[model samples]
Target chain A: MSTITLIGAGQMASALTFPLYENGHEVRLVGSPLDDQVIDRLREDNYHVNLLRTLHDGIHYYKESEKEAAIQGADLIVCGVSSFGVDWFADKILPILDESVPVISVTKGMLDYEDGTMQTYPEYWMSKLPEGSKQEIYAIGGPCTARDLADHDPSFVGYCGPKMETLHWIRSLFATDYYVISLTLDVVGLECAVALKNGYALGTALAIGMAEKAGDDGINHNNSEAALFQESVKEMLDLLKIVGGGVDNIMYAAGDLNVTVAAGRSRTVGLLLGKGLSIDEVMEQLKGQTLEAVVIATRTARAVKALAKAGKVKESDFPLLMHVNALLNEGATLNIPWTDFQKEM
Target chain B: MSTITLIGAGQMASALTFPLYENGHEVRLVGSPLDDQVIDRLREDNYHVNLLRTLHDGIHYYKESEKEAAIQGADLIVCGVSSFGVDWFADKILPILDESVPVISVTKGMLDYEDGTMQTYPEYWMSKLPEGSKQEIYAIGGPCTARDLADHDPSFVGYCGPKMETLHWIRSLFATDYYVISLTLDVVGLECAVALKNGYALGTALAIGMAEKAGDDGINHNNSEAALFQESVKEMLDLLKIVGGGVDNIMYAAGDLNVTVAAGRSRTVGLLLGKGLSIDEVMEQLKGQTLEAVVIATRTARAVKALAKAGKVKESDFPLLMHVNALLNEGATLNIPWTDFQKEM
Candidate 1:
């Protein structure tokens, strides 16, 4: 068995350690600087507070202080950090000398510029390296939730790397019957497709909150959710087209959007918004919680604004995203512009 | 005000009377020959037992005996019959002297042949008419549910016909602030796209049933649902492509499938299956309840088998549909063939 170094102890990273461990791989789950408490819990009783489950017993936990020792790994490295920990990983982990190992990340966010351009995390990380550096980071995106993955519920994900071998190697390393991996070379498309799912998922969850606020009694407002979900996918396909992703990738985006809308931290945020809680109130309430939808919505709106200023894209192109951006940023009310979401389809 | 004749007095037909009354149209809700009891309730208490709501006072209710009067001076005719009543409609209602009236149908099903061919209900109806019959039946499909429509939830639907005038006329008669109508000219594509939703919707609801059987405690298994949703769409697109439907129509299919999965009669049946109830058990449980998903799943399997016999399409192209068919028709177990669903993305 090869050594697989997982560089974060967060929910997704921790959950993924199961499949890797199940495949008999030596998984070194190195906690980030912020994960000291989690690392202590793991080392103490193998319990993950956030996941609310005991992890595999064979997993070797490492504190952030053991970076150099963890960095001298042999076979593969998985960047398990959240989008927030990316910079820390870059500053501390990237400076190590083992440059020949293959790296794949579970992070699902993008980097945008004021000039209205977007890059996947891998692209952004690759740009940070020396011009001739051969280090390539693979991309992963799909509907696999951490709890369900740990539960061994059937999950499908996509992995895109520099080559087919990179993908197949990853499949061989971590693929299980339940954790299905689909490989493609269009990393940017997969990244863009999945990143867009978060904001739109928040958009779809608006209905559940609205229903709760109205005191639903054994009935639902799923027609509204279905329309919103459809709008979300249409807008997501728009971004996928813009980012050079294929139409085939919409399945992945659909899967991600479906799960995010169904349950998760993002669903909670979306439900609160729909329940008429103001952005400030939600922010105050969910302090320190990782609101990826909020981050993505605000950033995507910023990028769209810059692009619209340059006449590269129109503001009305993403009415749902624009409306969510308004809710989270401009202090707009919970009124959705349903009429604006139509264009003859 | 133009006269709008809605035949069959069913849930959808009854629901549409609200919009027509809102628009000040003279609505004639004619109960089909089978709807005598419903008409009796409507006349007695102004209540529809099925919709469980009192309809508007403005709608002129017509019994089956008044069929001749209802057809005399209608500006439009809406074929509100289910797929089962299509033949009765053709035999009894198509003979009326209403040659110039525009017709639209809220029915979302198709007619397939043993020769591996499929025709939409409208096309099948047209085939039986006189060779030079100029009457064109417009198509409607989207995520609309009867209760949601009665609640005036924001619903988006596509109206595709032989001409734009037919769609616009229907839109004029029905469009409201909450009921959004998207117009297109791809009638065949819209029909094929929508007809495929019921069966796939059943496929997506398997996870919900499976969860119920496992006695989930404050937990979800949406990852499975999301994967099934993705698979359902992929297979729906396959049917759309085969039936000359465009991929652009997938949002309608997605919207329809999403609603069916979340909450509905079909979702109930799927849940029973997932909860370890056999097909016979589900059949006995919901004695008179409408099982559209079951009907569609069985018919789709029949057509697929015929097609496969002629080498028109492979049965594996629709693993989910075929599996559901086996469960409902062949007494197969509830085990979903998840591994048979993989192909390169």
Candidate 2:
């Protein structure tokens, strides 16, 4: 069995850990060195998935200092840490990882640095890797949520990276009856897919809630949704392309994720909005929870706006994107009222 | 039991028949003199929805001549006929029915001859009535589809007219455990809601399908749907105001008819599209099925376009509305790839 060491025990890390364990890997999970509650849960669940499936006896958990020893002889080093924690891990963990060992990142979004040139976790990690070790860092992406898989309905999605072998290794490690079809290779494409998909899914959730409140018959009319879907996909694809990703990113982003309707975290926010719950109430609920699609969409809008202002992207894409951001963050009030708008519809 | 004569056995007629009969109304189902399976089924069932629910012994069926006689002393003349047939009925049936018989129409869209006026079936019927008989016609609208009611899940919508008594009668005859909440009055407002909601639903469906195809997650990005939903509702409401409809029409259209994300037929089409069914295939399956929202959206787009061309509406609203029509018809395929355009999603 391949020895697998994963950094971060947040949502994505939790989501990734189960698949790796299921595929018969000797897995080691490490969360924040700071949060006692997070580390405690990781320590408890490190041996198994609680309330869902059986746990692997070979699985282990570690503190940050113990992470180096955990990965000392590992075949794979997978990082599912947040964007904010990448620098900390890069400095602390990279030094201990073997020079030949490959690292795969499940994190999306840019580092909130002034330059914004550094877009993803893999990019940041690759930069820190010793000179010729550039090809060792890969980005893993697709439509995946830990809650959905834990519930056991079959869900299919795509995953890609620049290295075909690394992609295949990751795909082979996660492919199962519950989670199927992970494509190997195309890092930029898959990265764009996951990043943009998160935003779009949140948007759909927000709209569904608004449509419900406005009493819209939730049916497709005049191809209204089709246009929005297409235009939004295109805009995200174009923006990603301009930002150094490929057009294929659009395909993975649009098709692979089975989250056409919102569920879990996004749905919770949407339902709260439907009940007229304010953003403050939502924030309160979200405290200490891993950042969700709603949070991601807001971050994306800010990132895109910055990109547009830097003259790296088209100015026209901002308004719609901004409006979408407002819909998710500020709630339906930021959107046009149902009755006032339905007249035009 | 009060005698209720319904003229039409189309989708809407078939849908409404069950509830009226179940509520203990002596419903006389009437249709055009044609040899059709649905008509045959209605006759055999005695206009009963027994196959759908429990058999209703109170319901009856009749020919056109029998309908005229049935309506002579009927408590209500409820028409669920097609838009094209409304005039024919107005010419033939209205003359024979007693002037005191109040009518409620479920048909939407304007009469072909009265293209300039945004008149619905009730309005067309009123115009043909003798002096002071205008008050006899009313309408029930918003997104209560026949399929939903036939499935037995409760569907709530709105009923409106100029008279409070007429609105009350419409609500009393229609409302049931399976059907609830018919917000009272304002015929003009009801018509505006009906027309606009249908058009916008179609637009929303197409956009959802397009986004799925374009490889973008349809979740929360841009809440593009919020824009479509809000803008389309506004357009419909404003048009109603500009052309003269009750303020209540906007509320009903924008509030009561909103389809649940799971319940919307158009969303089903989009989901099928995501599952790799072509639009043509979808249309074929939907052949002979009544998709009122889709039909009305198309009709609404045509009406809006014509109004725009005639300089009766503002040019500013043309892009989104016109684009909605184009997407519904064949989608914006100009320079887009066939795979991108024709992707089952």
Candidate 3:
């Protein structure tokens, strides 16, 4: 059995242990400083309060202080920290670790540099690592929710990176009958697709919410939702192509976007916006919740807008993105410009 | 105002009048022989029983006997008949149609011939037209439900054909502030995509039904549904490429598929099946309702299987289509082989 060191004790980190344990891998789940209380609880009872499930006996829990021990002699390391924590882990943790160990990231997002360059989570993490560290980094993406993963419900995820061997090893280590993995070489495209999905889902959720608010409760707004999805994807493809990513990478990523729009937290936020809640009101209502779409909308819009100003990207190519950016940052109303939507790119 | 003649007094045909009337087009709505009773009701009162909407005063309703009068002096003709009726309309009605006049079809389906050739409705109609008839034919497709269209809920449709002038004319005649029309040169792809959506929706419905049956009540299977959608679109793109259609035609078509899979009757049928009902039981349960997916699944399976045998198409490339066919035709259980699913084309 391979020793898998998972850095993060959040829902995803906890849930991922199920598949590792099922595959007979020795799991060392190390919590971050924020997860100290949760780690104490897990150590006390082996039950994850957030996931509402008990970890398998083969999985071991580790506190923040046990970081070095958790990584010692580990065959593989997976970072399941939130996108915000990736930089910290790369800077503080990578310097102390052996450079030869492979790393897989479950964190999904894009980082906007002050210089207007956008880097995917894996890219940012790699750049932050010690020069010449050469750690093979793969990103796990798609609509695999923590709750569903914990339930062992059928899930599919894309394993994407430059190193095919590392991807294959990571796939073998985590894939279960219910947890299927597909590999892709388009890391930039896959990461961009997953990160942008949150913003798009928010847009679709707004449609559903608007329909409901319009008192068309019994009406199926699938057409409108589908139209928005189509537009979102079109914009995504254009943006991906401009960002030097493969358009075909969207085929793998489209399903995840659909899932998120249909029923993810991003859509939940959009639903509230559609129900006549302003962005500020919605944010107030969702107080203390980590709205990933909000962050993505703000950062991606800023990054893309900067790119557009540099003539590297065309802003008109992505109306939905601009609208979302405006809604989040400029206090723009949630009234989507349906007529302004292009039928084809 | 252009005089527009619509041959088919079904819900779609009736709903379409709202836009034409709103555009100030004179509408002559003629029912098929099967819809004689519906015509009688429509004549008795302006309210269309199926669409649950009152016909605009400008729309002139006609019986099957009045088809010639309906078409007389028409600027444009639209066939809104079911796929089965396309042949009959082409054989019986086209001979009477002015060869110079243009035609548009709102009907979405494919016809399977005994010789194993599958032709979309527009293709079948085009083939039936006289040699050198050169009557410009356009197809209207997307996630447009008759109910939503009648409600004027900001809808978009793909107007596709080889003739740009005819397509532009039709778009202008049908375009309203809330009713958007986009043009495409990909008649084959759009028709095939729209026709095949019912089958894909059924497949997705089965997933949703299976999830509901699995006792995960609050969880959204959007991921699984999205996965199925991705597979469906991949198969569609492969099939479209084989059938001389643009793969990018999928961008225009994906929304319709999403809408259909999200809320179409095909998905409704799949839901019943997912609830542990046999095909026969589900058929019995949905008696008096038109199951488009059921028909598409059987005929498409037959046609695709024949193509596979002739080395024109690969059957293994389309596992979901094959599984759906077996479940419907071979009395096979509704067990989806998720592991056998291809991640990408």
Instruction: Tell me the tens digit of each residue's lDDT in model 2 across B1-345.
Output: 688888876666766777787887787777655414445666675443422432345556666655656676788888777765766778777788777778778887553222445656667677777887644777777655565565444444556666776666666776666565445556666676666666555544443554455564323322233323434444665667766775434434543223522245555554444344555676787786555555565666667666766888754553445554554576543121111111101
Q: Where does candidate 1 chain A have its weakest 10-residue lDDT segment?
A: A214-223
Better of 1 and 2 by lDDT: 1
Write the residue-wise lDDT of candidate 1 on A267-286 in tens digits.
98889999999999998989
Best of the two (1, 3) by lDDT:
1
lDDT of 3 at A17: 94
| Each model's DockQ score | 0.61, 0.03, 0.46
Q: Which ten residues in a row have the lowest lDDT in candidate 2 chain A?
A: A336-345
Predictions in order: lDDT: 0.84, 0.57, 0.79
Q: How many angstroms is the interface RMSD of candidate 3?
A: 2.4
lDDT of 1 by residue, B9-44 (tens): 999889888888899989899999889999988988
**Number of clashing pairs per prediction, in order:** 0, 68, 0
Model 3 regions more than 4 Å off:
A113-117, A216-218, B112-118, B216-222, B310-313, B342-345
Residue-wise lDDT of candidate 3 within B252-314, one digit each (tens)? Answer: 556777777677588888887777788889889889888888898888788888888888777
Who wins the DockQ comparison? 1
Once superposed on the true structure, which residue ranges of model 1 sit more than 4 Å away at CA?
Answer: A95-99, A217-219, B217-219, B306-314
TM-score of each: 0.95, 0.50, 0.94
CAPRI-style quality class for the chain A–B interface of candidate 2: incorrect
